[model samples]
Target: MDGRKSLGNHFEGVAARYLTSRGIRILERNVYNRGGEIDLIGQENDTLVFFEVRYRGEGSLATPAESVTFPKQRRLLKAASYYLHRHGLWNCNSRIDVVAISPGTVKKYRVQWIKNAIQAGF
Candidate 1:
């Protein structure tokens, strides 16, 4: 993988570990459909979470959260819908989240977890 992609993937792993440590059960990763992709699928308490993990190197063109444009939100919502329907969980309560990761010096990492990131559905 290229540097950026490899970094993003690594951040996803880190984010997953963080979430799991917080009592969330990971359901899937890098799930794709006609609409687009979801970085992570997890459950917290009684809620289903569709996580979008954004990783940025130094001097990023856009902030990790800002990278998720409106169109991107639509695609994410569609993918989440497909996931719910495919899993026969149409009635299941779901929410979107943003896991922003920024690499730091000295092997440190900065992470921000934003819950209810976007409104889901068509």
Candidate 2:
């Protein structure tokens, strides 16, 4: 794979491990459809979470979370809708989340988990 794609996968794996440690069970990863792509899909309690994992390496100007802009949010929502329909999970409780990762001074990476970071209907 390309360098960028490989890096993304590696970071997604990191994010998955971090979430798993906190009790979330991963259902899918790298879900792609006509709508767009979802980095991770996991179950937290009774909620089905669609995670958008963003990573900003060292010396980046924008934070990882800040990179998920309005357009990105719309694409993520569309992809999530497609995922639900494909899995016949219309009745399932779901939300879009963001896992932002950036280089850290003390730690190897700083991970931020933002629940319901992107909402539907817009």
- The best candidate in terms of TM-score: 2
> What lDDT tens digits, residue by residue, belong to model 2 across residues 7-102?
999999999999999999999999889889999999999999999999998888899999998999889989999888888999889999999999
Q: Judge candidate 2 at residue 73 and give its lDDT.
A: 88
Q: What TM-score should be assigned to candidate 1?
A: 0.88
Q: Model 1: residues >4 Å from true position, as ranges?
A: 1-4, 105-107
CA lDDT, candidate 1, residue 46: 91
For candidate 1, lDDT tens digit of each residue in 1-122?
89877876888899999899899999998888876899999999898999999877789988888888998888888888888888899888899999988876766877889999898552
Colliding residue pairs in candidate 1: none
- Scored against the true structure, residue 43 in model 2 reaches a CA lDDT of 97
